[model samples]
Target chain A: MKDRITGLFYILAVILLTTIHSIELYIGFFVLLSVLSGKDFIPVMKKTFVAVALFNGVITLAYILIKGFDYGYIALINLRVIDMTFMTFLFVRRVNLFRLFEFSSILTYLLVISYSQILLFKRYYTEFILALKSRSIKTPGLAERYGFLRSATGFFIEKSVKNSSEISLAMKSRGFFMD
Target chain B: MIELKDVSFSYQGRKAVENITFSVQKGEKVVILGINGSGKSTILKIINALLFPQEGTYRYRGEIITPKKMKDREFVRKFRKEVVLLFQNPDTMIFNPTVFDEIAFGLRQLGEKDIKEKVHYWADKLGIFHLLDRSPFELSGGEKQKVCLAALLSLEPEVLLLDEPTANLDPRSTGWLIDFLYQLDITVVTTTHNLGIALELGERGLVLSENHRLIYDGNLSEFLKDREKLLEANLIHIHRHRHDDMEHRHYHIHDDFS
Candidate 1:
């Protein structure tokens, strides 16, 4: 099954459960998930635990002060905890990192809108390099130019490849993996 | 002892390493030196169990290491407890927010309790106590390496494998790393393109050729003394020779040890 579909099911299930049941049931489901799954989501688990506890504490205190120890605010806060927790967990675990690259599909529109900005950056760099080379005016230095080209190409290729791979892995490890 | 007997590893068609044989007893600091395309990193990966050899055997203690053996989560978990690889790049190995979290990462993975105390102990030991709350990305290169080393040491692995540790560091940082390794009591297998760093950290050196073959294995100081041998191995450079002068033989940049 696709992870996104599974994630969607989890989200819908959490909402339905919280809507029908109480806050304790929601916390029970969370503890169950943490115990069953591999413990790779500790960061999110810690955050969820703290956030849920604080939310419940604040809501209960406000309810006691305003409504005289009534359980009315409990249901509202419980539903919220369920919805937010399920959505955040699924989003962190199921979404692919490169989904951010979907923005590239709008490149044509972006190019049209930012045409002047792009040209200004390109022209400024080109003119600066040309001026620097002109100042050092040495005619046919084949060996030196070849060495420079080799090192420059190697450096750029190494840097780009390293950056791309590092970003991809970082995204995946942070729970940005597709089903 | 750790032994790689007649081990070979191949890619799609080309061989990355072939028929390599070596061993290291407990508490030995071994350095593998090779040029850019010489499969030094591949050897490190093999030792790390990230890559299994295509043929022959890898024996840790007495039992042979194979895919089937490593497939056991219990065994793999135990093996990881004993040996750990420190990657070439700190940014890849460290992904936590603060220096403390980065050091705590491996210990947490191992399911060790009392994480806060362990983290603080290693942080203070490595002199990175002040930087515990600071983000790892903000620290300098030397600080990053120290923090990573502190993280690795917190696990107390018997064998620590380092890959090109000093490749892009300044001389001062490199020297500090060398001194740090010298004081450790674990078995060390480090690969280096830097001859100076290799000589400083290792008592035994293994030189590898471009073809991924072991070319030389011997003492570090004697290896450094041989100019012709170093030149033949593509390790001799002008700066190293000038510093070999009598008055400047010892590499002591800092007198105060700060």
Candidate 2:
């Protein structure tokens, strides 16, 4: 029941934050939620700032050039984006994604599998990069770097397919998907 | 009761194992021993019906098993529940958010009542009860293996198929697992390249040659003493060395390091 409520709240928050037009309200809610979440505020703000800047920086610049400086509207759009991002971060930190989707076993399974696969991919990619670094005495050239990336990508793709198939078989053997 | 008669499989035209014939009686523990790339794991996959045999038939409890037959809903459910395969990598087998859920997953799928009781029983049996709420991903390699074992064992499968169960485990955990498996009264088919561990796990051994053939299948103790057979299977290599001060040279069998 708690997980369901959390899921509903996440959906409702997304809808409200996306639909609401007032920038001040978004800023206030974002700040209040961030404070209540009790997470490291500066780091959360730093990540949110980077994401907002990268996502809206170009659009804001283009809008200013075309429509002149409507400071209030531009600020509202930027703040809304940042606020939405922060809210999502908070939601993810607060709720267990697997439990949140407990109503749908298939969805929960997919989320878990995808999460593990992503972790595996990251581990493999990091190992590949570390191996490259260990082997190279000096900085690699463009062609060498390209070659390394090509091989790593190939390995990653092959491993992903193999890992997914293995996981599927393992799950099946354990009575999953029997229904 | 599982039987494979003249079973053969290939991957994209590359033959894995061929002309394999074996039958494991109920409550019997059998070990498949082979070096890397010898198709030992492929044989286990075939037994679990994850891969179908291209040429022969597999029988479970006197009924011939085939891909088409497995399509039947009832048979698939029963077969999966009765025969569980614990993957070599615990990471691949573990998909639940916590250890408790991981063990409970199989029972829930089978629609088994008293899921919490069964999960707790097996977790306690495997000495992982304390880790019930912990994420499986956060566990050590041995702990992960135990959690996976608990998950599969909780289902109380009739036939347990393990593929290199100790590959990622430490010596202490491996010892514990061997002892635990010995106490379990269940039919087990395990694969391993380690000759000593295979002897410890089971009385009968099926040795796969480098070319993916069942070169030897008999008493593991006798098989280990047969130096020529071990050499042919590439499980050991004969080496000769002479000390500078010694008058004689001696030849010794060097077991495959891996």
Candidate 3:
């Protein structure tokens, strides 16, 4: 379960789902996935739909605007996207993703750094919002809101640049860039 | 005045504080001490209403402070003007264009007419008047902190909640802040891991253990004298030192705060 077999299995499933063109086959696959999801069927399906809704909505709208509406085509495309996303979610939930990537040191390093940066940014974002909330007796006006947004954007951009350089130096000290 | 009755909170499933209970009275200076990750900041956030306890009640001035209660506009207006928190990082609080605007932000938002007077007053008090025209982002860490404190204090809050107020300060700046706070009559609760400077910040101390429970709540100096409590909190550890040209191990509290 921790080896590349799990990764390969998901990759092959994705390829099959992508290459298939038959609507009936997609429906059948979706049903089978629902059965395999067990108690997670509803939650996974909800998350999968939510995840694909915006992208699917935009693309479907663009497709209609460019040409015309095709009901069967829309159903087939939406089904495929939902199924793929659902499978991916299930894969992440069930597998130890770090173990699957243990074969690649560079990947592990990138994952670690990205995870750390995400947590750091999340903390900073909360702090920014809370600081604003604690200081305000009334709702911020539009001009003040714009000021806060600009300042927050500037802060994040500065943080991103500084963190990247620091990470680059740390990686260099470890000789990670040796060619 | 603030009271937490068996307050407990967790982030997701991981507990940050477990059934922690304590109270602070009017015009009292209290310091919360713990090693890093011991929930010192979490308690401050609770007091500042940034986070709420999942288990028990938090009462401020005899009114149960809940999200619903806070939604009342009048209550919010009163609470916002009465309680203020200086975040651990000044950068998070420094979003205004200029130092002057930064100090006047809260006052302006509250529709106060004398924004100029209050901003100038606090800016002069914090000694950031020279940087009034400059952007807050351009200032040094200590200067940025002063700007933020001035902003929070401009509202004339009754309770000041400071989270590691001197974490980024130098010796001189820290001394200045300590002296200024000592003179301020507002009730203050400050969080810090610096055991050496903890007593200077407050007469009463609340110590949080590694498990995120309040292990000691009493006189500040008495808590410092209790070796077992300090050891339990992991504030003091065994140190290997040289005595009379002979090496020996002794219990010591790290003095890196100075």
Winning model by lDDT: 3
Where is the poorest 10-residue window by lDDT in model 1 chain B? Answer: B249-258
Task: Please state the CAPRI-style docking class of candidate 3.
Answer: medium
User: How is the predicted docking of candidate 1 categorized under the CAPRI scheme?
Assistant: incorrect
Instruction: Please identify which of the two predictions, 2 or 3, would achieve the higher lDDT against the true structure.
Output: 3
lDDT of 2 at A97: 88
For TM-score, the strongest prediction is 3
Q: What is the C-alpha local distance difference test score of each model?
A: 0.69, 0.80, 0.90
Give each candidate's fraction of reference contacts reproduced.
0.00, 0.00, 0.78
| Candidate 3 wrongly placed segments (more than 4 Å) | A13-87
Q: Which ten residues in a row have the lowest lDDT in candidate 1 chain A?
A: A131-140
List model 3 lDDT by residue over B1-258, tens digit each.
899999999988888999999999999999999999889888888887889889999999999888888789888888999999999999988878999999888887788998998888999998999999999998899999999999999988999999998889998999999999999999999999898899999999999999999999999899999999999999999968888889999888875552
Evaluate residue B254 in candidate 3 and report its C-alpha lDDT on the 0 to 100 scale.
76
The residue-by-residue lDDT of candidate 2 on A1-179, one tens digit each, is: 78679889878988988898887898798778778668567777777787777679898999999999998999888888888788777777678888888889989888999998888787566545543432232345575566567656655676788888899898999888764
- Tell me the spans in candidate 2 whose CA falls farther than 4 Å from its real position: A1-179, B240-258
For each of the candidates, the C-alpha root-mean-square deviation to the true structure, in angstroms, is 19.3, 20.7, 3.0
Where does model 1 exceed 4 Å of error? A1-179, B225-232, B237-258
Rank order (by TM-score, best first): 3, 2, 1
Q: Candidate 1, A99: how far from true, in Å?
A: 31
User: lDDT score, residue B56, model 1?
Assistant: 77
For candidate 1, list the clashing residue pairs, or say none.
Answer: none
